[model samples]
Target: MANEVTTAPQDTRKPAFWYGLPVGYMSLDLLPPAERLMEIINQLRGLPEQERDEADRALRLYAGIISLLNTNRVQECALGVHPDDAGGFTTSVFTVSTLPTSGSAKLVVAGLAGSAADGPDEGMRPLELPCGVGFLAEKRSPAPRSSRHPERSDAASSHIWQGTVAVAAPSTPELIVLQMVTPDLDSADDYRNILLGIARTLTFTDPARAMAADEDREPEAPTGASAAMRNDFG
Candidate 1:
């Protein structure tokens, strides 16, 4: 697996905002579960007849379902904020179709505290970003060689590209993690480039600054009876 990390200066704009995917790409939310399942079945049908061993077929199906479930979990995580004692975390995922022949890509975002660190036992490789650090890793599972076609034997691979950004905050440092996985190595580079571009748009703001900004805003007048009295007197 090949891994690389690029960094940029911190953006102090919106602390929280939505990230968009490239054109020609779509999220799983746009596709219903039943439709997605049918797509998977279609992909399986495209596999060569020799590659249709029971074990291999089962593994491919399992992997597809697992990816779908994981993406759903991330989407649920994105719906709310998670604040911890020091800081908190939230995440989201989007499944994209790059091309008909090229496999889909999974984009993920994880927001947390910069103070927390990765464990040594973790198998992920380190990726340094301007705000913080990140990790990247890949996994491969060898498909059982077809008894008929001995010459063709390449294992299926999944590339996981992940990065962490440590936003500059006064007390509790905010962190953001961006990740994307491409099941097919042939188009992994394209997916990686798309994710990197999205990661670049991340901006951070200090909690203190946000609070102060809120305080500076003028208070709204009371409504109904209070508003009528104020309008009549003033």
Candidate 2:
């Protein structure tokens, strides 16, 4: 044996998208019509100040946990119709990820709405919504487009349930899927309106990409309660 030294394999893991508030969501290609989003904002504006304050508070609370935007890497997007729209209005995108946390168990949000092919169903449950994109992208960091993120040391925990919000029919849910790397889908939510915001603000809608995401993919297995999570919070 010559001069040989062994080193543990490098921990080569990377995030799929930029950091964002664990509360609000980011749409890939699934952008909604300007008119609709404006309507929503208007409606929110119309809400009693108390209710609007609550929504704003929830957003800010989640923002505290999110990191920042990283516009360097190439992310995915999709567009689809509102479940209630008999006309099938297409908008929005979904990203392929593990989960955003370190959980071992999983959750699923399947129903009259479609099921996820890539992961399992933890059954329908309110996810810690702030533990999602909204909280992840709270503030923008100084890192480069594709640079590594500062450690998530300050990331605080919050409890924002992913409760069910029904739509008309022929409907699939707007899912916020979280997986534990041994990777069971920990949670899924009907986040249509939640995600619709991202789609609404963005441009260039793609149907093909959206279809691919919704199509069934095999579920990922998980490790201990310490595995990585993609947190596909679409």
Candidate 3:
């Protein structure tokens, strides 16, 4: 079982993003890119044969989640554009599990301009937000049925909703991408609303200025309130 907790950054000035997992859902601390790769490698070493396969599958899923939130690079880019050249992009990921179901979800916010101003072409619908042109689309797929129980026909589907909130700027346009996957379609709207709430909190900050401020400051502990929340997972 995974350890779970409700965690958030201490800085209120920073935007608050949400995954709408049960309030106390477990939070996994992602290692910085370089360290995470090595950690995964170490975990795979010398596992019992029976446990190796399960470990591999879980690690792969965790790795894909880590890649989606790549933040160590000089620029934060989302949906294939850099925030400076485009605007800026920020991403957050969360792990969610309900009884027999478990999975991860991600939110990517990007600054857009020029040709990129137009959001996704298919299944797009308008969204009303104070800062951007917003639209949302939901995608679904049948969950893999159990092969052993081929005769059991009741199977749930997974859902992902890609929502975009494009802010119209004469020079720099921006959009927010909320991609969420859940075990069933019934909760898709709930997750959509959660992402929308987070997007509404979005505000543009000058990355250059933020970097300069960091340069002048002394190194500090990580963002979360507790050390456990700051501990990186293998």
Q: Scored by Cα lDDT, where does model 3 land?
A: 0.39
TM-score of 2: 0.21
What lDDT would each prediction earn against the true structure? 0.37, 0.28, 0.39
RMSD, candidate 1, Å: 18.3
Q: Model 2 segments beyond 4 Å from truth?
A: 1-32, 57-74, 77-234
Candidate 2 vs candidate 3: the TM-score winner is 3
Candidate number achieving the greatest TM-score relative to the actual structure: 3
Candidate 3 Cα misplacement greater than 4 A, ranges? 1-31, 64-124, 139-154, 158-174, 206-234
Ranking by TM-score: 3, 1, 2
- Evaluation by lDDT, superior candidate among 1 and 3: 3
Model 3 clash tally? 7
Model 1 poorest 10 in a row by lDDT:
98-107
lDDT of 2 by residue, 1-234 (tens): 011111111132222122222232234322236686567567778789999988766644433422111131113322233333354332222332222222312222222223423335443223223223111111112322312433442242222222222211111112222111100012212343333232222211222343354455564542211111122222
Better candidate number, 1 or 2, judged by TM-score: 1
TM-score for all models, in order of appearance: 0.31, 0.21, 0.41
RMSD, every candidate, angstroms: 18.3, 20.8, 14.8
Model 3, 169-189: lDDT tens digits are 222221234444445344456
